[model samples]
Target chain A: MSKKWLSLISMVLAIGMVAVLAVGCGGPAKTDSTEIKIGGDFEITGGVANFGKSTVNGIQLAFKEVNAKGGILGKKIVLVLADNKSEPSEAANAITKLITQDKVVTVLGPVASSNVLAASQIAIDNKIPLLTATATASKVTVGDDGKVKDYIFRACFIDPFQGEVMANFAAKSLKVKTAAIYVDNASDYSKGLAQVFEEKFIKNGGQIVAREAFLAKDTDFKSALTKMKASNPDVIFIPAYYQEVGLIVKQARELGMNTPMIGTDGWDSPKVVEIAGAAALNNTFFSNHYSPEDKDPHVTSFVEAYKKEYGQVPDALAALGYDAALMLIDAIKRANSAEPAKIKDALAQTKNLQVSTGILTLDASHNPVKSAVVIELKDGKQTFKEKINP
Target chain B: MDSSSFLMQFAQQLINGVSLGSIYALIALGYTMVYGTIKLINFAHGDVYMVGAYIGFFATTVLGLGFLPALLLAMVGAGILGMFIERAAYRPLRNAPKIAVLITAIGVSLFLEYGSMLLVTPQPRTFPAVLSSTPIHIGGLIINSQQVLILGVSLFLMVVLTYVVNYTKLGKAMRAVSFDTDTARLMGIDVDKVISYTFAVGSALAAAAGVLVGVYYNSIDPLMGIMPGLKAFVAAVLGGIGVIPGAMLGGVLMGVIEALVSGFISSTFRDAAAFGILIIILLFKPAGLLGKNIREKV
Candidate 1:
């Protein structure tokens, strides 16, 4: 009797889990015949909440457009969104809620790759197709054995390509002979990009002069920056998020080591210029999913419509979110069924899908084989420099 | 590269370490003071520092105050908030179980963190450059004005604290109250007033550290208080809980050791190295470096 609370809580948890599993095992819960449900588990309120919010907005925009032109496959697209609060555990919980409680046919988002990796298994086990908008981690779709997971897919290019694109650009275009790397070893995204870039740069005949590491919480970079200055690398690669990347760029610039810096999509936030100051942002570039400066009509009109809807131009995250939802809808239409398996197969064969970023085509690994854009910063403005095709 | 270059690098790291160490010392002082006075961990003290930084942030960015003035405003704001927290939250749980009071302190901490997050989103704000941070090079050694300012302001605050705790009449009363609260009250000393003064002084020091960090790092956020707060507590314990100089020594040592580890070894194990040293120090000197063994009267 004294252990009643413990037993009761556990029993409730067990029952809830069973109920979820039952729903997963059963075929789709019959809702309105004219409605097809899709779930969104977004990181809408934590460190990467910006990505989540943008993703949700992007999905909403695509859904609204589809609804206006007669819903996909003769069914109204019902998006059931859940905020994961930018936590991994919450992302998993959101997916479970969607599959069991909402009975969604497929899911989208939980943008950051870490969250994607965390929530991927549940969707895999429960047989729900989960499509990520911008998660670039190679391991997100491809298993540790280097095989593609059946149900998990990403709307963006993988990390190797992103790192390769930047390294190639720096070597072949910018003609930088040497580079320094400052990475956040605590973050998988940063570490992944750093390792890939280092490998590819050396392959491209560029020498790594100095390599230093820091944590996400570390505010001081002078020690690392000072050492990097001694080597005098032609370029510095800080493949970290805006929080640390902005500071690194500013400090590096202030230290008079204004070697042109390159970063990944993590640096594609307005906070970068704000933290680093506009003057310090000069001569810095980053590889991203979409460049608003792209003259592509899809990108231009998406920016305009996104501005009208959200009161701001969509960032790389927003563009990817819209693209992911658009493709998912396209898959549903191509499959011509409400079944999850058919949709997954259709998603595998998606080709020449015109989205905001570029023409998206899903490779065998479930990652889009799309071109990546390198945007140059001028007075803190993102200018389209060149697009690297796969 | 060369010996002189190595020496220059060593000196530069030493400066960076000491500059960083001073802020830890400042934040650690608050923890030491609160624990010394009430035997409470005062988990919310770091949040008071966060409050101070935000105060300084608004003062500089919104009110258009200069660096010194903004710092003063931050100190005043945080000092008052510290007193208010002690009166409202901690005071209510004072007569409760020790665990209750400790839990309340943690609650206060989370409330401050999440409340601030709600008020000013979770986005990290760029702290305005109250002082120019352009590195001033000397020989091969590099020093920035912000580093100099951190070292200078921290030393000034520590010195002022040492003076206040050692010489002022309020200092005598605070010491008396901290030694034996019941006895101090029985002897006609204002116990409540002394504790309030202790919280104010301690909070002001933490606030100063907050502003200093905002300037040094050029970034501040609501959740910023958590890590530094825990680290300061560690510094307080490593120095010898309830001892002023012990906290200072512990903080400086921790900062120096961390700087050296990250600079020479690997920054990935920076936190592990810090906690690892703390474990070693505790194993050797259980009462901290400057902590003295006091016989239990009971």
Candidate 2:
């Protein structure tokens, strides 16, 4: 009888311990707040951690600056951060947790377009205002109606504009009459950019000698590069992320296909240099949000501050994240409330706001009509080339 | 496509397929050999390949070793890692159920993959150029010198392995142990030492394949080995598990078939074609290509 009583006590203790552990693991619950809360759902750990880390740094810097000037509407802005680990499913879960548990008035994040697509449905269902910083896919905001999304906004310019800019530059600036495109068929970003570039280049009276497709994770490009070389194109346009782009560049060089290469915003990564040696990367061009060489006082100040804090110049994603946060703060101050509906309304009216990238004006599709700068790699340094206006 | 261009492309694709097949054969031998001796599928074998690639990467890029020295170091490093894995993970469970060892192998694989990702950055790194950069042309076919080197090395290793398994004293001991561990032990063979040696050989071959593939492809990532490892496993099973020559045959056949499917049919069905062949083969030949049927004792 005493042994049975002891067993029962132990069982009760085990159950209590499990319950406490469960509660501890669960995220903090939403509480009545005099604090204006904003949640960031980002990939802090995963293949794309560097991109996520840069955006988080930008967001934190903006938050610190805003809070220092007396929090939005005299209420201290509380930032809640969650790591999504660069997985689409995790991004969805993080957004749901941010909305339901944190009760954040607004959300900023999810750098990848795939992750943004996964999380956007939750934002739409919950009627929460989500402003993405780095996702450039046009379909993220525009639906079948081609109109601005009511609750969704993106700080980056759409792919179609960037793609056309690249194609035009390749033809007129690089003077390439024949081009080849190596696209990652598995990625919507790669496919969309390739389609746009192909169409615009063909329209400009340039010939597309070969169009090759590869899996995103494909490491072998010899066969593809061989085929591309046989076609004898003047330039190769690879519309993929830096991971593949770097290797492709290196392999293409090794194969003696020394023609200049072009890419999109995905080329803005330090890994590119590590993979494609600085010497091999010469003459490559890419379109980005903003270059560090921009002489605008606002741009110079942000560059200086970023270098001071991080000991490195911020990439386009970082600038966009900083701009997105400032935009959110402006909306909140204009609305004079932390209510989601009011902030959504204020964001829709955002215009003529000068940002680190350029003057921000949301188009009908809720994408920022920002200027894109074309950067060229010369002697291992990114030089300011020309700016294209959307 | 024109006719000559089509023929040229087809020939080029065939060469590419064979080059890839050679790498697959190297890895498949490791899988088949381990399965032949011990019934456990060493899922961690792929990570062993990944470790080899990293070793080569560090040796070449960080330590700045020449090509031949870096490769030798990578093989030795991988052999040591393989022996360590056998001692730590598989040794304790020699008498356990096959499923237990299999699960443990998978656990070890995951541990290595995630551990590598956490320790090293998750991004893919470019492998240093270690092979010749020129391509050789023969009649309508063009092949890179690196591809030729890969094929030559793979064939040489396969031949060496076949000889070892057939003639050497260690080989005889391994065969005896695989046939019946209890009888082999009663005969005074050191089962533990033979098993460890099998892992070392298997892992060394996988390491060579890993570094070769990395250099040939010019990119290496943490999860790079998962798909190739799965395909190589299928190749091992298709060729008749336990048969060294059979694994090489199966690997080359699988590679050529995949390339043909991608070249003639659709690139999208490349993976499906490889696995579909395996399923069909399994349905007809349950014991595999060169597999022997063993009657169980009542």
Candidate 3:
């Protein structure tokens, strides 16, 4: 009976393979004249689903507008989305499927820095240009040997830039003499930002009174906060995602260690206010890619369109997603072809392209030399404070 | 650091540890009680705690119940779930190999975790503030109202548990069943009913711990039970697997050790410290701190 079942299963598999081959041979080529397919590898379902969902929304909106304007290069841009499920291994699988199976010309996203780093090598091997809107880790575009991955690029500024911006903001704007560094050990993004912030803060003539590390998903931070409180730094730099950040802030405030706290773009989610109460998040600041409150015509128009479409203000991830998609579209238009290698060259040479964020130009590292905005949280509202240009 | 500052930090972390340990102790009770009777570790105990938190979340948010009512409702809901799980999953495996029952428990655990994740998307929900977390300072030591509530509720439950076990007729029957199920049945005590009651009581305690943790942490997720559950199981083992008071003591000690390790050594090693202690204890005292070694009859 077992042998008979095995034979039946093998026969079914043989028939399925034949059907797939027949369809492959008979069907039109995967990419046709009507649409130009780009791949979207995003965290559609796991821990950072909100980031992925927002990014996809921004990408969809950008493509919608571009397609309505008689398409890019006279062919409508079609985004083939694959969910990474917020796992790095799954991210590699998503990108591989997008490139090998779907055969997209360009791939965008997998928003988290770690996810981008995991999937970047695949794009490099496949010679397909991969652009990420919100992955700010320096390693996303550069290798360990300090060489840029030609096929990899990001629309947002690198971690060191944002870290330096915050370090400068704390030392100069906030006039902080001593600061503590609370880093998430589990995240490449958090560690990169924390490392840079430490160096730049000390370079800016400030002392790091305390440095502590925590794994992500740790709910209780009181013990660490108490330990850090003994040093009593003027400000605490927590370069972690909003989930842990909200808990840290709430626990810190509850513990009566209410020093000013600063963070990076990971704190941009509205969930931060929900997890950490509105009152607890007061006096906290985070560096972000773009602020919707910006008076720039490009930002206002993009913000208005995003609000009209999604019925909410676009966060930094959404803005970067839109910018990344627009930048890719711009590169494609400049190259005047849908070829991946040409698009990579055009992307590497990106110069002074006006987008929702600001005047975006690719640096030597394939990172955008754009400005970072400092957003101050007051009673759960993100009030724009200052914009620092690199 | 100066002696005064070091001492102050030590005291603060101690309070924090006890508060955390109380939650562990509450979950540990469920493990201890269920294991005491049936000798089967309910791996799904932690997920039951997670379900309880969600029940408390909905009770507070949807039904607009206050803290006490929501907590009570969560306990009742989880208690029923515990009984249902025991009846459906464990009862069939009563005469089966112990390994089979253990495997079923783990299967039930996974089912609850992913099933809840599917029901409530993997997104972490912010549990509404059921109690004011106003900090009360006593010298350099600061304690929040929520911490006080956790300690109060945990202590109250432990006292009630002690009384019921020592004085009540049902508790005597439960004790009898744990000692020898065949003898208890021969003595006309319905063994099945006692087992069901044990599960109900254990699950209710876990639910209470869940609600309290939600109040303390302010964030609840479907997978929240995995870590705390394992830690509570360790606490039960460290205290003496089937010993009630031992579970409490082990839990508080575990919490304090975790707090001190994170405070003095490093936060990254806190989890390592917990399992490390468990290994050391198991190596030295195979029967646990309070467990007595009884040679099995030939």
Candidate 4:
């Protein structure tokens, strides 16, 4: 009699698990007309949690400002957040829950390009518009087939633009005749920047003296730096995250290879200075979305407002996050509807929409055409160098 | 590449390899010594190294201690944690099957990793600089002061460990216990105390390596032990498990090979070369470079 009861309980558990899975996977989420739900799939807890937290903070600030002004279409906007854990697989799950369970009209976030790509499929499947703030890889908006992903849009400039900006800066501004490219092979963002930098540098009549790749989480880079030092390039383009970049720069300086090292916005975090030390970062520069030191009234106001809200200066990710939220809210106002299809149409038609970063205009590829700022490191502090317009 | 530059590059990479190998040697000593006495792999040894690094970080940053003090504190802290782990986890499973003990070791490793992760979070912390890293140029090859310090400290510890293992009364008791546990117990040498001493000494050495690695890399994380632990285990096996001198040799060889692979061949295959060497060693010389093959009486 006890054995029969145990088997029956096991059968019930199996059925219950299946039922839970069904409820999780299958759903047309209920729509509440009183408030518009916007999903946020963020990297709230992993390797790039800082980036995720900054982006969410910026998005939340934008929503708070919007809600204070009576929101859009007589409905207050609510942000439903899910932590992606800074992994691509977790990003897919986050987006799935946001769309299938929360029934949000639009989704924002995930700073890394690879994560945006991971979550894009879920949004496309659900026919909900997805806007990424800081994912700059070109393929985020366009698929590999060179077709625009209809349901996907971004608020930041593409990686090609950043690469071209740095390449032109290296050749025309710095007047470096030869360059070296050291990239992180693990990150698509790094590879994307390296490829374009190489092409544009060679096109500008500069030579690439050395090309080396290192995987993420590698602590020792002395051997690779020694190899690069032999070629003796004018500058090194390390298009990797700040974690590895800090070590690479530190080792390179220790090996007496003190040429200017340039990178992209991935080096915006202050931890780079902490790891590499201020002296090693003296001649380094990186392109970013916006500079907190910009004297422009729009930028100044945003910087002051962010400092008031978060009690710290907003980084590039936070600025881009605010811009993305502002763009999405502007589209909702233009479309005069909370429907995802209408929002996507209005987003595609965005023109001269002034944001925290710059005047954002959506291009044919669903990418924002905006200006980028170059920042230089001096004594471990970021200084505004130049702003280049597209 | 010209001959002069080629020679310089070779010399540079050699220095790099030696510095790196010394760190592996420090971790490998713990694995070999623990395996020598108890015959358990003690997979939690690497996590102890990681815990040592955190302790060092806290000692330097929170307690505001200098380099030597922080290093000594971390060594003592990790040593106590090692004893507690052995008592609470391994001692209970002493009479169990080998597989059961190994599984328990893996479980202990996971618990430490996740538990530390919960306390510290998954974010990687930057280790505070305890020493100047200015490079010294000599004969077209650059060597940093930190590298010199690592080599010096590791050598001193190895020498101390060798003297303790070879010339001390406790060393004799340890050898007897390792040879035959029942015989040693019968001879009135408290077998459990000897084993615990082995663990404490080995763990202290690993903690030193952990603190040194944190200084060298300028980064520390809770899960930092997983890869280095496996690599040190490989080093122990390659050097002849349960042998003191062999672990040191195996670790240095592994480090040099990895540096050469990264320098000449490719950085991508560096990790692959380590595991590949393990397979080759197991197939060709299962007794390892210094291990003696003992036939089991069945």
lDDT of 4 by residue, A281-335 (tens): 9999999889999888889998888999999989888898999899999999999
Q: Which ten residues in a row have the lowest lDDT in candidate 1 chain A?
A: A23-32
Query: A1-390, model 1: which lDDT tens digit per residue?
Result: 859989999999999999997866564556777889999999878888867888899999999989999998777997888778888999999899888878888999888888888899999998889999888778899999988899998898987787888898899889999999898888887888888899999999999998899888667786677666766789998888999988888777766677899988888788898888888999998898878889888889999989998899787888989999989999998999979898999999999999888888998888898889999989989899888887
| Tens-place lDDT digits, model 4, residues B35-140 | 9888999999999999999999999999989999999999999999988899999999999999999999999999999999999987789988888898998978
Model 1 misplacement above 4 A = A1-153, A296-312, A321-346, A351-356, B1-4, B89-103, B179-187
Write down the DockQ of candidate 3: 0.47
Question: Per TM-score, what order, best first?
Answer: 3, 4, 1, 2
TM-score of each: 0.81, 0.78, 0.86, 0.85
Displacement of the residue B85 alpha carbon in candidate 1, Å: 2.9
lDDT of candidate 3 vs native? 0.92
Q: Backbone clashes per model, in order?
A: 0, 0, 0, 0
Interface RMSD of each: 2.7, 3.6, 1.9, 2.1
Q: Give per-model CA RMSD.
A: 6.9, 6.5, 5.3, 6.2
Best by lDDT: 3
Error of 1 at B233 (Å): 2.8
lDDT measured at residue B170 in model 4 versus the true structure, 0 to 100:
95
Give lDDT tens digits, candidate 3, residues A312-365: 988878898999999999999999999999999999999999988888999889
TM-score of chain A of 2: 0.82
